[model samples]
Target: MNEQEKSDGIKRVIPARYNRLMTDPLLREIVSGLDGVAEALAAKQQANVLFDELGTPPPDYAREAAGFIGSGKVDKDWIGRVAKDELAKLVRAEQRKHVSDLINGCLTQLDSIAEYSVDDVLAELDTRLQELVQPLYAAGEKLTGVDTPTDAIRRGLTEEWRLFADAAIEYAKIRAAQKIAVSVAPEEFKDRGQSAACEDPHANSSVIANIAEVWESWNTPPQAELAWSDNDEGDRVARWVRPRVEAPWPVQTDEFLLWCIRNDAELRVPDLGQM
Candidate 1:
């Protein structure tokens, strides 16, 4: 890293790293990858419930993994039902919270069955490998020389973690921290993070609402603001005759999120849950 000098004339603290991350390409990729991973995991969980109903274990999460990348979409209809199935899986003594969630209409725990979770699969693979190797060890064979399944999985995860950490550190070093969070999300992961509207009003109305609220909080249109100044009372003084800002940065952000929410579908599910 090149040694950079700070200006000696200033000592103001700012969220330099956070500010830079807001527009960092690598950060965007990692964040998108994370959302994709999370949704896949949720899908895998839903698939497991289906497999349990079929009295079988999913083979390498084939059904879930394929569907997630294929025509997988969040089935709002089955959201409650799938969650109920999962809740039923718990032992009689351990389902208190989940049961409450179901009855209260908070299906937040049960949803989106389309993709598979890498961590879940890796963990399961490690478990199965241990089950296979345990017997061999019982017969006096030394487990050595080759990377065990668990070791291999851990090794891969560790490397990925290192890479992610490195990217974040590099970003922080080069950029400044700023905001707590942003609403930006990649396609297939609309409105998955902080509060932000989708680009399309139909995709996420809350996005429009959010942007509108911010813009009109002062009674101005979404794409522009009225001119104003402070009065003797230390409050904003109206300046109606000033020019308006057409299509500000926030509007651009709204468009970005809306496009993502609209196109970020895995598979369109019927709105039959209303039934």
Candidate 2:
């Protein structure tokens, strides 16, 4: 078929394939489950059971159940029923946990799939394949003393086939890397002060100073007068302060510094020492 004919055929086939995909039950389930709608429904059913037992509507069930549990009017039969129901809940929670884990795995796979763009992959393939075949085309022209339509077509096909083989090999490598990335925890890949340092290499000293300042501020003891206060004794004094140097940066600077300290990066705040 000619190029236009082939293009037209692809256009028609793609829409039909898309329609079929959209109508697929599995795909519909996946799309709906992306927002945890199914999990919400299951939770709602559990809530309904609790509502019925409490003899109250869903909205008022929580208060009613709390009162029922706290009241001193409980008998042996009530205690046994509650215990039985609690055991049933524990069993159901264990089963749901297994299903939740499986769903999470599927969601992670979908995220990875979504990360790749078909157009981008196709473009890269085309570019790399062209680069791979250029030398072959040049060699063919040199051997023939002059380029011809037949020579060009043969060289193109040779390059295309070689590209296909190379693509398969590259695809395997990509899959391996993706698997490794998935297997590794995100926190494991996190660098200490590297992100802050990389954000502005020219202002490394300022960045380090700011990070140290924030860290010290977080761990510093409250003033003597403030120490006696209740608010200062809690999270009030422990609240994170964003580093001045990394202010314009998107990430949480204090958290990044903490990660750096935890990972034991070479970062040091002159007077502050190791951290």
Candidate 3:
């Protein structure tokens, strides 16, 4: 690229990088605990018992006649009945323990992949991004306009946040990095020798440019439902079109726009445009 292009590219960054500021160490722990409990419940074992009748007793009429004579002795066993009840209780207890172990296993295994994966990249990106972004929330209210606290501080934070986010998005798009035990490159790559090429600043710069372009392009279409009429020589026609926004950009807008953009599909189309 030309020197001017390269210079401009070097100056761009993405907003997602600032999101790392919101990272909470305790959040993962809580999720892991919940997962452990869910797994424990899911892995429970069950116990059952079956009763067998040794033989059928004689018919009521036959037994009644024989009861008066009393020629034979009645024999029954209590040991078998007692043993069955005890076995069932013991089996149930064992099953409960087995289920508990399963839950513990799930808790331990939550999001702990040995190699690089989408989740791993996403988690890193989320945590890092939040860490960089959370500082912007200086007031009690949610983030609205860019003007807040001190302008110089805000600008510096914004720049760094964009840079980090841009780098992360570019890294994720590569896709090849999602391999076994692959170590992601550092944020600022340093050339070690003649064998390696210089870091591609344009890679991130291009992504940021695209993001800005799409945002501006999408914004060009007014979201408000406008009411206007066309007058023909002998007829009058009136119509209105309701606007809608779909995924991807909507996600980005909601995340970065402080929910100022439509969320939960609830919008106010006032007759006079008042809140």
| CA deviation > 4 Å runs, candidate 1 | 1-32, 35-181, 184-240, 244-275
Candidate 3's residue-wise lDDT over 167-222, tens digit each? 44533433222111122223222221111111322212112323323333332344
Angstrom error at residue 168, model 2: 34
Candidate 2 per-residue lDDT, tens place, 22-138, comes to 253433333333444355445645644543343311132345456767895545575566667667766655554444444334434434332332223223333443353344333
Candidate 3: regions farther than 4 A off = 1-81, 111-275
Better of 1 and 2 by TM-score: 2
Q: Which 10 consecutive positions of candidate 3 have the poorest summed lDDT?
A: 46-55
What TM-score would every model get versus the actual structure?
Answer: 0.15, 0.22, 0.22
**lDDT of each structure?**
0.32, 0.36, 0.32
Cα-lDDT of candidate 2: 0.36
Q: Write the per-residue lDDT of candidate 1 for residues 1-275, one digit (tens) a residue.
A: 01223342212223232223336454433323443435544554564464334442213333554575677664555546555655554542233333322322211211111112223322332343334323333221122222333443454544423332343343232212111122111233433322222232223222232444333332333343467888999998775553433332223332232222233321111111110
Candidate 1, position 187, lDDT: 35
